[model samples]
Target: MALEWVVLSYAAGAEAVMLLLLTLPGLDGLRKGLVAVTKNTLKPLLSVVPFCLFLLMDIYWKYENRPSCGDEHACTPSEYIRHQKSVMKSQRNALLIAATLLLYWLLFSVTHLVIRQQQLSQRLEKLRNED
Candidate 1:
């Protein structure tokens, strides 16, 4: 459980770093290499999608199966504390999940745009040289 979240965190962090590098200015010299790396990485990083879905379903299952701590007649003080902890954990995990998905989407879109711009610029340069 903890391991899953750790992996997800690493994936999210990597995506963020890649996205940052892609958008960062003054790396024109490295732009080609960055674009290549980003293109290659985009495929593997896609695994994060299914992994996120699994985590989401896990969250849902846990939520449905969780013990109700609100029953005053049933839940002890310790149980209530545990319930609060679980709820907090779920919220935090959900936020992380959302962030991870969003980062992936942004990274993919940015990489595509970068590649398309490069292609268009190259074509324009070729046409100019032909004149």
Candidate 2:
């Protein structure tokens, strides 16, 4: 569980860095490379959607069927363990949702950039033709 948190933290940090790099000016050359990678990786990135749904369902199920933890003094050892497990499960599900959201953001950014580039090219072509 601890390791999952660490991995999720790193993933979130990397996504932030990628977004920063994409938005920074004076990096037009890097932009192309980033977009290319984004486009190529999109198909695989889509695989996250189903996994995210699964995580969400699992979280819902856990929430709906969770056993009562009762008073700390009255809680059995097994009940305490079950409560801890539920807490960990919730954390993992939240992390998965965050990662899925980040993936979608990256996809949207890449598609928007591609469309803008195409529009610019078309406008330039029309201008040249009018010359």
Best by TM-score: 1
Q: Residue-wise lDDT of candidate 1 within 31-125, one digit each (tens)? A: 99999999999999999999999999999999999988564558888988999999999999999999999999999999999999999999999
Local accuracy by lDDT, each model:
0.95, 0.68
**C-alpha lDDT of residue 79 in model 1:** 83
TM-score of each: 0.96, 0.64
Which residue pairs of candidate 1 clash?
Answer: none
For candidate 1, the 10 contiguous residues with the lowest summed lDDT are 68-77
- C-alpha displacement of 12 in model 2, angstroms? 5.3
Clash count, one per candidate: 0, 0
Candidate 2 lDDT by residue in tens digits, 1-131: 45644644555555566666666778877777876676665566566566556666767887888777666447788878979987887977687677756756775675578659867988999999999
Model 1 gets an lDDT of 0.95
